[model samples]
Target: MATVRVGEVEVGRVQVGGGVQIAYARVGHGPPLVLVHGAGLDGRMWQPQLAGLADEFTVVAWDEPGAGRSSDLPAGFGLVDFAHCLGAVIEALRLGPAHVSGLSWGGTVALELYRHRPELVRTLILADTYAGWKGSLPPEEVAARAEGAKRMLAVPREKFDPTLPGLFAGDPPAAFVPLLGTMAHDVRPETMGAQLLMMAEADQRDLLPAITVPTLLLWGEFDARSPLSVAHAFQDAIAHTELVVLPGAGHVSNLETPERFNRAVREFCRAHA
Candidate 1:
């Protein structure tokens, strides 16, 4: 089995549906909580949350197929396909009724998991993500995002720092830059394109009402990727859901504001899981 080490977390591979090797890691010990990352980034993005949450709950963060330490992209993989892959991990690890947490694209995957396999999810933490991404971006913004994604994927890994500022609304902590650099390098361009295409085609508005499990909608007040209004719409749609906006935060809330993110997650897990 191949492995990729990042600080304390070790990325290990596991076979999911379609015979794909999904990379994952588990730390600390208690009820299991799965942390999923957004586009371009990998499971390593959950560094802050995994370290903090591991103290009380067993956190298993993994790279989606083709991201980070995961095997190369699989054929015919879509959002629902990604959801099934997670389901395979839960079954393989015997971590049923797990608390599932996802950010941005990761959140979209978690929503599908809950919708299709509610039995696997005990609770959900959907952070800085939207149920419906369609019509959210204006024609200009869509064009810009598409161009930006293309540009991001085209650039050599060493020259990618220019886009870091956009991930965080304000000046980021010094520690984040090098870490992001590592993540940016680990991802392949084709995988980035595939994930972006998945986002472009995803529309989960109709699936919201179907999610009956306890859900927490975590968002950043200044989030550009998923606006506050979008988060509120999720709050209104999900049957049982709560909204928590991180003040002065953006897309990567857990990393941008670790203390607040950890507190909210820790408290919620203690209460619900």
Candidate 2:
């Protein structure tokens, strides 16, 4: 295993399916906890979670394909490909039956993983995510989101800078904004587009009733992007699930309100473990 540090978090890169190398950072030691990051972000997005929860659990965060050290996304790549890669990473790390947590788009990927390999996931921690654009949201809204994303892709980089504030309902951390800007820059345009397309076509509503493991829905109280309605739909659909809405936070709850976010997740994972 190779180790490198992004800040204080020491990360390692490993070659997985089809010569794709996935980059991941880990902390602490206990029952394995794998964190899947949202679209447009790498594993570093979970820095706060790793720092806060590492004392009690083995926290591992990964950079999805084409995001960090991972290989370029090939043609025809979709959610199934992402899920397969997720499984490969878990297998490579030798983390048996881990508690999986995902944020935003990562949440959808988590569901896909569960559908593909039910044996690998021990518990589900989905934060501010939709079942898929088709699963929870209206068709019109999905079309709008897809169009907006495509427009953003066509616009110049400078035009995209002004929209970053929409990610939160309240003022985000001063340093957090710059950190996000840097992360956004690192992501290739192709990766962003592919991830968006995957979300656009994802449909996991049929799989919700089949989820037999413990599930927790962590959401931002004022999340404009995903909204409380989506959380309600997930809670109503999933047979066994609890939803916790963090007050004063937005889409990116972990970075926007790390203390509350960390405490809630730690309590949930521990109660079950």
Candidate 1 versus truth, CA RMSD in Å, comes to: 2.7
lDDT of each: 0.81, 0.85
Best by lDDT: 2
Alpha-carbon TM-score of each model against the true structure: 0.90, 0.94
Span of 10 residues, lowest total lDDT, candidate 1:
158-167
Residue ranges of candidate 1 with Cα displaced over 4 Å? 1-11, 135-140, 147-165
lDDT of 1 at 124: 93
Candidate 1 lDDT by residue in tens digits, 1-273: 456766766567788656789889878789989998888899889888878888888889988888887888877778888899898888887788998999988998898888789999999999988663563454575566667767776877666533433567687667787888788777777787777767766778888888878888888889987888888888888888888889989989989998899898888878886
- lDDT at 16, model 2: 71
Model 2 Cα lDDT, one tens digit per residue, 22-65: 88888888888999998888888888889899888888898898
